[model samples]
Target chain A: MKVTVRYFAQLRDAAGTGSEQVEGDFRTPADLWTHLCARHVFPLGAADLRVSVNARYVPFEAPLGEGDEVAFIPPVSGG
Target chain B: MFVLQASPLPGGADLLPPGDLACGGVVVFEGRVRDHNEGRAVTALEYEAYEALAQAEGERILAEAAQRFGPVRVAAAHRQGLLQLGEAAVVVVAASAHRQEAFAACRWVIDAIKERLPVWKREHYVDGTRAWVACGCHHHGPEAP
Candidate 1:
């Protein structure tokens, strides 16, 4: 399946871009992030991040479908 | 009014909802970009968010806040992009039939934003250095040793 991976904050800085597309057999959000951490050398652990699939916060083990929009949420610092 | 603004949050302190006989109290809170942080002379801040998720989460929080706080109407706005010192980075307002619920809702929304929202803050210091204001758990920068 083809997955679009998005980076934010430090993850974006490390990867040099905010988003990209990947083609792999990754079935879960954790799998996709682990692949990116290896490919881009992300500084944080894949398990340490929060993820949302299709604009909704979900568990790391949430299943990913083809052409899913996944977001990696960093520790929030808003008001 | 859970919105992700790309520009400055002007008049944030005055953004409130219309009051009626039903509401006896209104609470407003603004999160400003302070001039200093962590013993550093901070000049500016950069706020970034997963806009889609941020919006969805923010709206959800507003819905939940209303349900939790009896007879309260709440709204929130968070800024994105670069913000100078003293700018209103975020604003939240709650109006309720009584002071207690309004106050509680105001506090709850802001606290939840800090914890649950997907936004991240990057501190730009005056000494030509910048760092992502980490939450003590995540945010290992580009070169984490």
Candidate 2:
């Protein structure tokens, strides 16, 4: 399966790119994220991060599939 | 207009969309960029967002506010990219049958937007330093195992 992973805020800065495409058979978003952290050391971790699948906020355990858009959301500061 | 916009958000007496005859009041809130924070002299702020997620979640929040505070129409817009100090970073407006509902709905929209929206603010200080603010889904530094 393939998924498009997007990063926002500081994570984007840490990763040096906002989005990327990856091929994996991860059962959950957490798995995909772990793969990313291995490739690019994101400054934040699971406890301070929120995962979203298909643009809706989801738990790290959320299922993943081909063509899914998975985003790692950092703490938002907008008021 | 639950939106993630690039320009300044609009306000004033015309804050709410017209047509509701029962609109007895409209409440508005604008969050501005401050000149300083934590003893750092701030110059400006740059906001970034996951547009797709932010838009979807922003709309959901407005819809929820309207549903929870019955008879109210809620709209909110958050800015992206660089924002000068004192500029409006976000604006929320609510119109309802009365002032109470209007105020309550407005408050609900802002709170939900802050916690749920996928927007991030970066503070540029006068000393040539910049840092991302800790907000939204998480706070604190790295945690223990």
Candidate 3:
């Protein structure tokens, strides 16, 4: 299933774009991350990042749906 | 109230809502961009956020603070984009009937924001190098083999 992926901070710098559409039969966020890592040299690993689907935080193992909006969140540093 | 904006944040006093007759104590916390970090002389900092989720999560944090320390009113705002040294990057204000709750709520809100907000800071050093500020609680650098 295809999904829209969003990147922020370091991931954004690595991805070279804020968001993009990826076409693949990705089963979960982890699967999608693996696919993305192959394309972009992200600074952090999947275990160090959090996954959000449709703007809500979810486990990396959570299932992905077609047209889902996914974001790989890096370590937050807001004050 | 929780807000993420590209414009400069309101002054600490301006961030507080109108006075509440029942509330006798008020506390405000402003996080400013410092000139140095990690032994490096920082020139400036840029903050980026997942606006949609950051707004939602930030509002949730304020709501949680209100519930946890009831009889208090809390509000917070975080600035986006570039910020110069000594500029207020974020602000939090809390008012309550007594000093303890107001102080506690204000502190709680800021701490929670640091941990949960979908915001990132990039520090630009005097030597022209830059790096994302990694939260000490997370393993953010190069991945382990």
Candidate lDDT (C-alpha), each: 0.81, 0.82, 0.87
What ordering of candidates by DockQ runs from best to worst?
1, 2, 3
Per-residue CA lDDT of candidate 2, range A1-79, in tens? Answer: 8899898888888989888999876879989988887899878998888899998999899788889999988877776
iRMS for model 3?
A: 6.4
lDDT of 1 by residue, A1-79 (tens): 9978788998899889999999997999988887777788777785567888888999999889999988887766765
DockQ of each: 0.59, 0.58, 0.57
Cα deviation of A77 in candidate 2 (Å)?
0.7
The deviation in Å at residue B74 for candidate 3 is: 0.6
Worst ten in a row by lDDT for model 1 chain B? B136-145
Q: How well is candidate 2 docked (DockQ)?
A: 0.58
**Candidate 2 residue spans exceeding 4 A from truth:** B12-15, B136-145
lDDT tens digits, residue span B4-119, model 2: 78988776344567778888798888888888877789999999888899899998998888789988888888889999989888888998888999988887777777778888
- Select the stronger candidate by lDDT from 2 and 3: 3
Best by TM-score: 2
State how far residue B24 of model 3 sits from its true place (Å): 1.2
lDDT of 3 by residue, A1-79 (tens): 8999999999999999999999886899999999998899988998789988998889989999999999999998876
Tell me the TM-score of model 3. 0.92
Model 2: lDDT of residue B9 = 71
Ranking by lDDT: 3, 2, 1
CAPRI-wise, candidate 3 is medium
Whichever of 1 and 3 has more DockQ, that candidate is: 1
How many clashes in each structure?
A: 0, 2, 0
